[model samples]
Target: MPLSFKPVSGLRLRWSRLFQRAVIAAAISVAGTAALQAGDDQPNSLPPVLQSSKLRLEARLAAEQGDFLHAAVALEQAALVVGDRETAQKAGAGRQQLEAQGGAMADFQSLMTLIMEQTAPPAQWIMRGDETGTMTPYMQGVFVGAPALAGAMAMTFDNSRLSTAAELARTANSNSDVLETSALRLVSLPRLEAEIARLQKSGQPIPADAAALAGLTEVQFLFVFPDSGDVVIGGPAGAWAQDEKGRTVSTASGRPTLQLDDLVTLSRTFADNGRGFFMCTIDPKPQQVQAVQQYASRLQLSARNARQETQKLEELLGLQNVTVAGVPADSRVASVIVDADYQMKLIGIGRRDGAAGMKSYFELAGRDERRGAAMDALRWWMTVGYDAIRVAPDRRAFEFTGRSVRCQSENQLVKVDGSREATGKADSANAEFARLFTEHLPQLAEKDVVFADLQNIFDLALASAMINTMDLDRQAGWQPAVFTTAGGFETQPVEVPRELMTAAASRVYRDGSIVVQVAGGIKVDLREVISNPQSFTTAPEVSSQARNASPVGQTGRWWWDAAVR
Candidate 1:
């Protein structure tokens, strides 16, 4: 009856190995079955090839037949199997085309490329500028192409500080011309130099600026996406300016001039290096109104009653309209002015009237009671805190300055409640409750407290009840309520809710000009810049220039691969 059992280590190991083999066999069988099913559904009419060109043709045929999913899958398999640069590049292009055709299976590489296509400054634009600064006092234009295409993109920036409106318009036109011409020159620089050499040989006059081409700084950035998922950057070797002595000098690193060949080497380095691709609109008041209206429509659909409540609140605030206007000046800071029209709801209320309203709102606990208290707060705020609102010259934006009125102050407390006796002694109980609920409970959750922990749940519930009670007391004009024990009530400092304190701490009340930015449906991808630095330094395709000459209607800014058709 007392027989002992001995452990068998070899038996356990053998069983584990057997289980693993069985699992692997099952997985292989499932995969094979799925592949066979797919083959049955869409029989490959052509032979699978190791060449990128053949794969691309196959993929294109599939796409034309509205089979982008199969095209993407086939191209990806070819790229992986062939493992060549050209095949990989074709795979990348195929993926983009599939995405453009509303395929959802695009990988990270293609997504990155799409982002770059949308945001990266054109190669020509990059060549013209040493560096690009964001949020500067200038207007920027971005050009993008169909995801299926490559080598045709650009962006431009125009200064907004001309003296007159007419002058600004004229300058913008001139700037566009300058940017286009500069792009053309960069792309055709080699041809131009060759022509210049021929002219010199034939004893023809060469422009004085012809020799300046050799000194043009070449900017190269290498983006390496290695298998280990690291991105390494290389040089931006060329961005040179002429010194006082008429010698070429780099604007940034003071490095030696880089040539086109050097840029190619850098690109090759990036291709060999990185694991991932590099990572890095709107109008004025009528546009603002349109956006608000659209949002309102959605809100109405979701919650009609809530929308009605919001309209009532807006009416109570007497907010007619708010406008934002910007003035372009010589300074780096763009000046924005906001003007607002207000018609105070309870403007003519006297002190007696305010007291009566507070009594009705708080003591009677009448519906819409907060409206009276809000009026009192607004009247006090306007009288003691706000300055007169003024309209700007354009009559679009408004400017006004005001400080927030603190209701916790003794004067403000008396102004709102009419008595210090109404302000109950604050105790640490409420503060403790807030800390336990807002801070400690969240910490417990982070610490992986089990759902079965009844004690923790009970503590949380107690804290929530305390917070609710405090909120109710505050609404009844008995804020900072003191809990009295058998002994007596202890006088404590007024305790503000942690949420209110957080909100107050985050508020930025400043005297600086306001800038209202409307996005222009563009973004920048630095990875693209790093990968193709030479392209930026060369002449853009003439077809790209033609496309940029005209404006195209834009759909929505955001797009999903599966929904892009």
Candidate 2:
């Protein structure tokens, strides 16, 4: 008998068995402790008995002990750890059964409900274009929202043009022929949190900070064109026909008729790699954007503090009468301009001339003494050079010519300027700067600077100035207005909605097509448009082609079927 036992099949199998035994032993020990303390009136204060690492063992032990409530909780925890919705549902059913048997635990029941709810798959509402006689989809989009928020909404755009460097990169590397076609999906925070929780329980890697998850509810996807010719057909020809249920079908002889619902469904069912289908769900809840804004407000406040500190430092240095001029009248439009000019003025009290000289100079001026008395008094001192005089005036102005160029395949703004010189009075310097800037107005009006470039410059300048000049202990956080650059110029700052910012960030692809799914917060009220199909006008007939019949020369029909099935 001592020589009868053979080694295990593999080291992995042996290790797995050892691990299982250890987990079982630990679970039993914990269960024993729980049982001993079970009689304590306040079970709510008890430590967690089941752990994700030992879920299976805990479930088995609880079941053996006839502790159905604990068994149900263990089962749910196990399912969550495994990320198996089906298993979770099974645990939910088992918990319901336990509840019916005798005394039901309210906390256990609530947990079971939460597990079931969190694991349930979302519903998809799809929309398709009405154009007919074409295989290419004109417009196709879908909506998906979480169950948590009752009124969350999301939006999609067709024929959107890309402007950001990131978007352009996505388009260039995409395998799909239609680079411009893309989709944006928005999700709610609760939905995101649920996903993160599930991932955490499953021991999957995710960002540890909850704030990192903020503003991440948006996702993007590309749409790929479908293959030509039907699989059933030996040639390129295929027919559009009605199925028994009145659904539009694409098929050939001796093949299954693929029912077409919307482009997303078609792509998911027929296309490879989910090219035409958005791979993620997005939260469309308003709270998601509000979270971003709250963070943004904090950053804005920090920036304001930095500016105030800079002003105080300037006062302490006695750099009075400082005036800034030639800044773009519209800071928002400055980014798109081809050039910017600036002028600065400062009053320099005489250096090392002592406080008495400065006081007497100010006192004499305050008394309205004529220019001759001050000039004569100052001229009596040969040591004081005219240039070193307390009130010696200085003015500076410069023109920065900007050129848009592509660097590393990304649009960039390059400034060209080397010369610096002392100019005339503040009025002349400012006027000269303004005149030079106005010369580039035509170019600014015609071309738009890349939003990425503008955002980068603004963020860097603001953050660096705060950290370096103001000597801020913490780096100032500034939120760039990238959202405003994406087709949001029409609306004023106050009038623009936060949802528009989300939309701008998820703009249409470069090729001009877009798809989006939003879930949880505000609902997109497409119910009226979806329900009242009859209200839409019908497309006119094309060249005597019979209704429901595939046109001879045309590849496909773009129009929706009036009578499905």
The digit string of per-residue lDDT tens for model 2 on 396-501 reads 0000112211100000111111001111112222223223322332233222222222222222222111111121211112111211122111211111111111
Candidate models: Cα lDDT each? 0.21, 0.20
lDDT of candidate 1 at residue 298, scale 0 to 100: 34
lDDT (Cα, 0-100) at 408 in candidate 2: 8
- What value does the lDDT take at residue 292 in candidate 2? 25
User: How many clashing residue pairs, candidate 2?
Assistant: 33
Name the runs in model 2 displaced over 4 angstroms: 1-265, 270-531, 541-565
| Model 2 vs. true fold: TM | 0.15
